[model samples]
Target: MGLFALLNRLFHHGPAWLTFLVMGLAAAGLALCSFNLLFLFQANYHLLFTYGAMAAFDGGLLQFIELTAWGYLAIACYVVAEGCLEGLLTRIRRAQL
Candidate 1:
């Protein structure tokens, strides 16, 4: 029963392949950029490494806090827009009926 319930829950969440695909593409792009910065652009490697280390050690929390605020704002805006669209569609359907 638990297994069936879990499967049912998963099935209801919609497909995940597209999300995974996009995430994979983004990871690949980031890897490529890092590879290029570290290898292809050898002249700037030391500067990049220093900055990266600084961000990794010193600015980690600061970066997360700053980026998280922007992320939250973007998500909130998306949710509001989605709700508005859904409400508008619902009203249109009711009017048609």
Candidate 2:
């Protein structure tokens, strides 16, 4: 469906394409960042390669030890919070319907 339709479904329906999409993207972001940080760690500290498995989420020269795993937790929280928010929105919309 189109973007507008998709958004509508997200704000309207409880769980469907939109919810699944959120979950999928969230998972991807988690996996991507996890390995990206791993790459940064190895590259800077140990001078190793991560087989480019982190290209998607790699922050390039923005690597640091502070936000390594925290980023993953943040993404996961966002996904769950978003899913719940969308679910609440759906309930509200359905009630109005």
TM-score for each model: 0.41, 0.36
The candidate that wins on lDDT is: 2
lDDT of each: 0.47, 0.58
> Clash totals for all models, in order?
0, 0
lDDT of 2 by residue, 1-97 (tens): 6965655666456465556667667666666656566555666443224433364246533454455555757566466547646676667777898
lDDT tens digits, residue span 1-97, model 1: 9955643333333244533343345445444434433343343344446678664566554554554555555454444334334444455676799
* Model 1's TM-score against the true structure: 0.41
Q: After superposition, how far is residue 10 of candidate 1 from its true place, in Å?
A: 32
TM-score leader? 1
Error of 2 at 34 (Å): 2.0
Each candidate: RMSD to true structure? 14.0, 8.9
